[model samples]
Target: MLHATGSKKELTRLAYYALVSDILEHADVQALKQFRHHRYTTRFQHSLNVSYYNYLLCRFFHWDAVSAARAGLLHDLYFYETNAYDRTESPGQKSHSAHHPEVAVQNAVDRFALNPLERDMIEKHMWPVTHRMPQYKESYAITFVDKYAAIVEFFGLGAQRMLSHIRRKQTV
Candidate 1:
């Protein structure tokens, strides 16, 4: 069982690290650090943030934290360089937003013994963009958190940045 004590942000960080420790140790999961997600964030860092938020939400709502954490961590597991998609001769090549979810799902499935909910969370995270709605609460949680993390990463304003900002404010 995980314990939460401290500021909300600190508690969430603790829960996230506790929940995702196992997944992070997987060789396949570790490879995510090699891929860039958006702006200054690596796929591993973005996924960690998503997984952390999912875990925090699910824990608060009494949902399945395990599934949410695992699926969220694996949600962007499509290992190809995203830039490569642009090099195709034709426009029909697997575009990141339209196609990477399916690819990520397959990769997650191949390596992990995922439950249906976990699989669905990984498969349908892109939602209306991918035309697949989440079939479970955990799926929805992961989907929402994934987008939130992406926005934070895209702007290079995630927890680390927030912390830096906070410290600078305190010193002023």
Candidate 2:
């Protein structure tokens, strides 16, 4: 229903603007731009992509778009260099996928007045890897969108191409 009056691109842009308009100017959120995420993408870029995708899905399903967008944007708020982790290390000093969610949740809570849904979404985006299911629909949307964004970033797709690719995948 929401997309009926506008092109997907237009709708996505609107949703993206709604997600970032207030948070973009926040110093801590802006600092995310400096951290590297998947491949060559910055943490800010990846977060934006995830938030946008989550926003689209939330709008499509008539879910909590604001909460999904906010949680998606902060899902990877952990500030350390993720690439430094050694795969061979023990559980206590391993890859980021297992630990960053908790750290990110803590950081987000410290910086933002997050609702329970947002906190759950941020803390459980890792899903089966973390063994905790999302307690809210928006949280599930964020989890899926986060994975979608990660795959896109891993493949080095540009913004326009990423949207197109995601659209194509949605159809299949």
Candidate 3:
């Protein structure tokens, strides 16, 4: 990663290494490549979107950009297999969405040797909306950004499909 200018360079370095290491350890390259090449809406893209939103929120709040980006990127570590939802669900049962975050937190801690703050951010990113309320300011920042990104991704998927439908109609 390029060196970020100004105050939090050291902290950013620490967070960046830990988070990237965690991602590499957990994410399968074949799966990621298949998702990217097959045009699947993927955890990788989701993570990137979350990271971007976290950057925006961090800048707005004067938080550590590196830490925020790391937290966002690593928040969905257990989502290496995009079909997890399909595997866990049986016919009528609702999605097992709530479990992934805890699974992710555990995997991240074990894989990356995360510090307390980094762990907190990964663990609490689903706050208010999914999990319990976040305690730390960093956790709160992740929570805010995660939710915002989710909404944006939701609308983005809709827009993409809408445009595809329009193009299909024109072709026909």
List the candidates' TM-scores in order: 0.78, 0.78, 0.68
Clashes of 3: 0
Number of the candidate with higher lDDT, 1 or 2: 1
- True-structure Cα RMSD, model 3: 6.5
lDDT of each: 0.78, 0.76, 0.61
lDDT per residue as tens, model 3, 134-157: 666878888776766666556666
Candidate 2: list runs displaced more than 4 Å. Answer: 1-16, 92-94, 156-172
TM-score of 3: 0.68
TM-score of predicted structure 2: 0.78
In candidate 1, stretches whose alpha carbon ends up further than 4 angstroms from where it belongs are: 1-18, 158-172
Best by lDDT: 1
lDDT of 2 by residue, 49-163 (tens): 7877787799889998888878877888877677665455575673577688999999998988899988999998988778888888888778788887787677645565678
Residue-pair clashes per prediction, in order, are 0, 0, 0
Judging by lDDT, tell me the better candidate of 2 and 3: 2
User: How far out, in Å, is residue 15 in model 2?
Assistant: 5.6
